[model samples]
Target: MLDLHRLRLLRELSHRGTLAAVAEALSYSPSAISQQLAQLEHETGVPLLEKAGRRVRLTEQAEILVRHTETVLGQLERAEADLAASLREVTGLLRVAAFQTAALTLVPNAVTALARSHPGLRLRIRQIDPEQAIPTLTARDYDVVLGEEYPGQPQPRVPGVSLHRLGRDPLRLAVPDSFDAADLADLASAPWAMEPSGTSPRRWAQTVCRTAGFEPDIRFESTDMVFHASLVATGHAASLLPDLVWAATPIPGRLLTLPGSPARTLFMAVREGAHDHPAITAFHTALRTSLTTLKTTLPLPTTEADPAS
Candidate 1:
């Protein structure tokens, strides 16, 4: 019989595409990962991997093994879910990952709600970018991930992962009090701070600027939204800021609605079969409740009505 653990390792290698990546994600050395795959090949009596330049590619037999491994993994997830449902209470740890803004704003409230409702269940969360989080989630590093998508730029669907929409977060133009800006076009010549290129937010921001008839002068770039807000607050730059940034405080500067009053979509993601896990479902409930509670406290910024909504 093939070893299930080693089979899982093989499956991980296929998804991750490199032994080094698989090792880093799962916290193993590259040599250890290779050694395990060697053992797997010994048991299967076939070549599971072949050299392709400096990297490796899975053989047909390895692909067959990975397909079967996926089925086994899904079934195991169902069995675990069923077992948890049969228990008197939800217990054990749930690992979660979220981007910076969500981590700062919504997750704390969700944590409080979870603690009050399900004291037996424990949560472990880390701040991670959605770009890096999704692949790690597939590797079983995190049970759930909170992510966002900018307007008109829907993220591509990943296989073996299930997504649940949380809510839309309103985005507004944040300008320094010292700068006079009424709309996106007014800031065409103003220095701006935005997320780095290739990020969804950066692309959406650029599209918004282009649609307004001028390319923005992005003088600063960073992934941290709070820093972007700071730059705006201190009169260094302007930014397209999300509502979540002001969840716990007043808006730092003048906020104007973009041409269409665009909002980003937020969602939770989990493995396909683990979506029904009791702990995951409970956390999802807490997140929804927190969002509803937070929206009531969010400051209303003066903005044009959203015709598209």
Candidate 2:
């Protein structure tokens, strides 16, 4: 019989597209991953991978195995969910992946609520970008993912995950108080600090800046939004900021609205049928309650209301 564990490795290879990525996500070495997949090939008597340049591609037999793996995994998830439902108490470990912004703002409240309400269930939260969050979730590395989508750059749907809309987070322009710009378009040439390239925030920022008629003079790149806020607050650089940045504090710098009052959707995703699991439900409820509290306590800053991202 084919080893279920090695079968999972094949599925992960299909999802991640490279051995190095799969190894990194699962905390295994590339050679180890290769050896296990080779074992599976021996058992099945088929070529599961073919060399293409410096990388590898899945063979037809591997694709067939992946389809079966998906079904087997989904069934296992349902079984686990069912078993958990049979119990009176929510117990077990739930691994969660969230980006920096949500981790700071809403995730804490969720964790607190879960700890108080379901004392037996433990949740592990890791800071990860949405770009990598969902794929890792599919690899069974994380049970839940808290993520956000920019206005135009929506994440493509991954198989075997159920997505839930959490809230809409607005993106705003952060200009230094010492800076002088009467209109939003006038700051195009100013020094800017933004999230690193290829991130959702950076993509949206570039698009909006181009539409405003100038490329940004991005002088600083950091994944930490707190740093971005600090840059603007200290009058060092202008930045594209999010509502989450000011959720726990007073407005740090002057805020400008995007052209259309654009916003990114905050979301949660879980293994397909595991949404109904007791622990997952409890976490989701806590997230909603925390979001409600944030909206009530953090009053939206008054702005002139112009067009933006």
**Candidate 2 residues 93-133, lDDT tens each?**
99999999889989998888888999999989999887777
Q: What is the C-alpha lDDT of each candidate?
A: 0.88, 0.86
Highest lDDT: give the candidate number: 1
All predictions: root-mean-square deviation over Cα? 2.2, 3.2
Give the candidate number with the greatest TM-score: 1
lDDT of residue 2 for candidate 1: 96
